[model samples]
Target chain A: MLTEKRNWGWHVLLILIVMAIMLPVLFMISNSFKTLQESYHAILQLIPAKPTFSNYLTLNKQINLLRMVSNTFLMAMIVTLGKVATGLLAAYAFQNFHFKGKRLVYFIFVATIFVPFTTVMIPNYLVIAKMNLLNNVIGVALPQMADATGIMLFIKAMGKIPASLTESAKVDGIPNRKIFMNLIIPLLKPSIISVGAIFFINSWNEYVWPTLVLKDKSSFTLPLALQNYISSEGGTNFPLAMALAVIMIVPPLLIYMIFQRYILNSISTSGLK
Target chain B: MLNNNSQIEEAVNSRYGPRASRKPRRRLLPFLYLLPSALLLLVFMIIPIGYTFYLSFFNWNLIAPTKEFVGLANYVNVFTDPTNQKVILNTLVYIVLLVILNFILPYFISLIVNFFIGKMKGPYKILFFIPSLFSLVVGAMLFSWILNPVSGPLALFLRDFGMKVPQWTNSGAMAIVVICLITNWKVFGYNFILLLTGLGAVPKNILDAAALDGVPKWRVIWNIVLPLNRGVAIYVFILTIVQGLQYVFTPINVITQGGPYYGSSNLLYHTYLNAFVLYKTGNASALATVTFVIFLILLFIEIKFVEGRHKDAD
Candidate 1:
């Protein structure tokens, strides 16, 4: 039940709170439409009186926005696919198999979750450079292929699947492969979406690794493109930077807005699990 | 009826046709399934840690063809460096600031929305969550442009009220605070949602019964809600300490570059600077080793705590 003292004061207070959080975002969206000259002339203007697409055009001129955006999206998709596939298989193996060294293998995989990427980042960079893939999107995505948290999540989701369901299928003369295909995979469908969406967003928003790997403007991820020439700036660059940031931010925001329940629920569930 | 385990076992055993005759078929199957992830872990994570430690003992700029045997020199320098000392101190400061901004403040914010205000909770949550969806880089850039200390929108906005905004980059302490706020904005709502879920999971009946007994709200929240939500609260706590430093890395790079005499730099950003900016691979490796050890200790404690809980449930 709702609180008894839900007075008019509460609604007003809530709206004010919402606006405080939202105004900066509104500020970002509004400024993305401004021209460089207008942006410089009125830095405090939330809404550009004469909005123009010139900033976005300059963004493309300065950096290959189309190419970078596509590359970033492709990188996200590849990493997400790799994580889900590897994590699913690994989780399934741990759930069903009586193999020797199972606990040790599981421990090794899960322990990597605690291994912050910063520590191993240098060596990983060296290896990638050695592979001559410094500016490659695959190089950026390669080391991030196996997400330990995703494996752990899948394992937890799988553990919740009743063992008797698999056993019943076995007694009914269903083959092991068929049982896995029809029963196990279907039951894991919800978790698959949860992990997949999480992985996609994470990979999409990833910056540090890509910053290290993707050096060329053409190969730059969205984050890289936004930050590429930020330091050495003139009047034109800030508006262009704002345009790139707006482009970079929209998809993830849309993803969050549409599938927030899945994203948020998965986080709470995975954190506790 | 539930004790039909023996019969089910018999059926499974017999269905495979004589357990004694059964062999470990496809014994390598599970290994095959686990291969892709294991190899990635070995090459990417396990080997790199060992490699970083090995590099710490050598003096070599990344491009230099030769590496001199400088045993313990990098470690000594990393330990003795005044800038590193400040950064080490800055890390603790980061943890305190981050926990307050990202963890504790969000706890009360959620508490108000869930228990106090009680209206438009869903809409409020979605709006709050909006900031978290954007990349930390975007957030840092946005804040950097807005809070540029001169001619930025915020400075201009405040000028109308005869107020002056601090040039945050000029002071180390202020820079750290500003960067933390950038992180807090991006992370606050996500933590809010996680914590609110935890707070909401406290059984409503318990609170209702306490209300009937005329038990004060603080007593119920203090004695009851906090304990029930302890697991999640701890989860967010560890997350803040572990991931918070990383989140600040973007802003630190974009805004300050660990500037104003390295005031805003943490160990992670410092390590990045030493390795990439200065190409002091040895020093960075040593620093990275130190970071690895601290986090490992935390992870082990977590493993022990979680294992104990699982044992209790079993």
Candidate 2:
């Protein structure tokens, strides 16, 4: 009975911490639906007196919010697909085949994980510009697709596959490509999904590179659009900005919800490794 | 028939290359498989880094026809400039605060979440981790609303309680603190999840024995669990430094613009300002090269200390 009481105490404490952490987010959502006056009201209110969709309407009318959403989604999907495919092929080769310079190649690939995009931003921009891809979504997505973290995670995941399974297939006259497709790819589903989800979230949230590369307002992703909106409007239009924030956050949140298990599993396993 | 049989045998032997000779060619297939990714990395990552290094010595505005080679002049300017000094100081403070908070707070939170959350761990983790899914720009904007002195909820609540709330964005030190808070809010969950996994890997038998021996819970964690989980702790430590430096760029650009007299600008943001905004590609490249060297040093240390330990244990 005493232990039960202590447990309840801890539960309440944990709940309070969680609430405090989530307050800004909750307030954003609540204020997003509030009238402009209520959103700017002096007193804090968790629930709006009268909820309205006017803010969302304003965002759509002003910023073409739907277009930005679709743009972000498309960029994220392309980047994720590219990263997954490249990461999988590279990981499979590293795990299955012995090459003379395998160690050196692996080192080069893994080293990029530490090389923050900031360090390479200027040169990458120049390269992109020279290629005439400036202000293009493809340009923004292309450089981001080659992710070191994705390769590392995939390699770790592939390492878990039993060597005997592939060896037996080989002995039975199965080719390497066929084994990768028929056997390894099937086993890699969870890691692939998790890695894909991670890449998608990352690309969706990416701000700095896209901001530099993409100059056209029409080519803007959600974060860039929201930033422009804030700078142009300043702080006066609180509800409208909050509404935009909601739109920017919802997709990644939904993705997280759907793939929470795989994401968490991958994170934990990667840490252990 | 005999001649035909010998010819077939010779063909098979030539093709197979006597097994030993086959090994060399077998190694080439992996290289073929690795070509696409390697090419991408070379073009995008490796070449860019080399270019960054090369640009550090040149006086170029990125569009100018001739980039005059001014070898090490940009590096000298980076060291001597006062604004760059402030940026470096701000970056150091940001990294220190981030490492401490990110390292300590998340560890404790993980402990609580791991030991105390019980069956509700999943729900709790999801709730805490929700903030991380938001883009840093969105988060900074959201907090800007929440921390707006005039119309913000916290200000109003404080006023009602006869307390004072500082103008968060206008002040320099306070802005940095606010930025740190928001960053911690968004980032803590990732490290928490990492530490929790580390704790989970602690040997159950040793923990049970510690409990039986009446070793206090804190002691068991500090002395037993922590020592055992050093690899993860170092990993989290390195991540805090790396991601912390990178994460501050978004908020500074979006919310502060290194505002209130450049209080929040770090080396990364400063580099952006130099290259894009100010069109001083030389200075920016120099700064980037310096920061890259710092990162390489940190990575080397991690490899030597953390990964080196793993090797020793094996």
Candidate 3:
């Protein structure tokens, strides 16, 4: 009887934490369709009386949601491709080749992990301005592609591949570039997907860099556009803003839901230690 | 490749032989492949860090033709300024509170969840981890609408019960504190999943032994479970601290803008405002330098304290 009671206690605690985590999301989704007056009614209910799609319609018309979505998708796709290609090449080099200043150079890259991006915001802005890439997707993607963490992660994953694979390839008269592309790259797909998922989410969510660099409203990502829309209207359009918020969150959430199995498998095995 | 005859010739003639001689070149390719990463670190990371350090000593602005060095005057002024001092205290308090609450809460939650391994666990983990999938920018925007004191869901819910809901983002210090708390929620799932993975690694036999020995449930948790999971605890600690720095960005930038009255700026956001908003590149650089030093000190402590334990355990 005592053990039964204790089990119930743990179950109750679990339920409460789950509730705490889910409460905001539940509230957001529920209020998405509620009328403004009903939304502001004195009771916090999880259901709406008259659920409508007008807020969603209003958000689409006002925010240019489609263009922003396409821009974000295009940029995320480019960043993912660049990160996977360059990141894999870098990792293969670290794992397969022996060179001078190798350990020292890699450590230098790792050491900068703590160097906050704000430190480089001014310098990067200047560089982007000089390159005449402002308001361009390339400018947005390039800065993000300069990712040390992705390179480091890929290198660590590559290091685990048996050295004999490379030796056997070399014996077969395979060139280094061909070996990396044809042999090594296929084996490291899981690592690529795992790291790629993280990078995709990050680039999609990025605001400050994009905000500062991209001056054109049409080029703005969802977050920036939504922020500007809300602030300009003095935040009065609660229903529309909430609707836009739902839209802004959907893409990354969709990607995550689809790829979550891969993410979990890779992370559990990677020894994030 | 070397000729077949040379392999036999070299094998007989040399101490290291053909294979040993080829080892360095093989290792060398890995480093060459890493060259682009090296250049990026040098250009983007290392040089910028050094520049920030240099800038901190001067009253540098983008518009200024000449930068005048002011030694440690900026640091002294920041430390002495009542407003700046309060911001630092508030930032530290928030970080400490988050580290304590976020780390232990997830560990215990994972501890309980790990006992259920099949159908129940999969859906439960997904449920808990889903919200973390949303980007911080979107999550912040969503919450801003929910927390609006006048027209937000929270305010409306309060008014129905005939209680006045406090203005969370507008009224005094509580606004900044509440915003920080909201930011903490977004990262909570990521930390929980990480802890769940760590807890999953513990040997079930040992736990079974504890149970067989008639050990009390709380005792099993305290003595058997917690110590074994020290590794995850350390990992969660380090990652949480790092995430804490970036988390302040959304709250400071969107909801508060470091305001009702400069009431919410932290070291990183203050540096951002200086560099971007004020265009005071030099002072901002100085501020970045300060933040970098603080990060270094904390990182060193984490390495020495947490990572050192892992090394010792291994």
**Per-candidate chain B TM:** 0.87, 0.89, 0.85
Better of 1 and 2 by lDDT: 2
Error of 3 at A36 (Å): 3.4
Q: Order of candidates by DockQ, top first?
A: 2, 1, 3
Kindly give the stretch of ten consecutive residues in candidate 1 chain B with the minimal lDDT sum. Answer: B17-26
lDDT of 1 at A4: 60
Residue clash pairs of candidate 2: none
The local lDDT score (0 to 100) that residue A57 gets in candidate 2 is 88
Docking class of 2: medium
**Model 2 — TM-score against the truth?**
0.93
Q: Which lDDT value does model 3 have at B274? A: 77
DockQ of each: 0.56, 0.63, 0.42
Interface RMSD of 2: 1.9
Q: Write the per-residue lDDT of candidate 3 for residues B148-185, one digit (tens) a residue.
A: 66666666667779987665666536755665566667
Q: Summing lDDT over every window of 10 consecutive residues in candidate 2 chain B, give the lowest-scoring window.
A: B17-26
The candidate 3 chain A region of ten consecutive residues with least summed lDDT is: A229-238
Residue B127, candidate 2: alpha-carbon lDDT: 82
Model 2 lDDT on a 0 to 1 scale = 0.82
TM-score (all chains, Cα) for each model: 0.91, 0.93, 0.88
| C-alpha lDDT values of all predictions | 0.81, 0.82, 0.71
Candidate 1 per-residue lDDT, tens place, B1-314, comes to: 22373365467678776544224534766876788888888889999999999999998888899988899999898779899999999989999999999999888877777777655688877788888778888887777777766657888789889998886778999989989999998888888888888777778999899988988777888898887777677777777888898889988887788978988899999999998999999999999999889888877777766565456445
Please identify which of the two predictions, 2 or 3, would achieve the higher TM-score against the true structure: 2
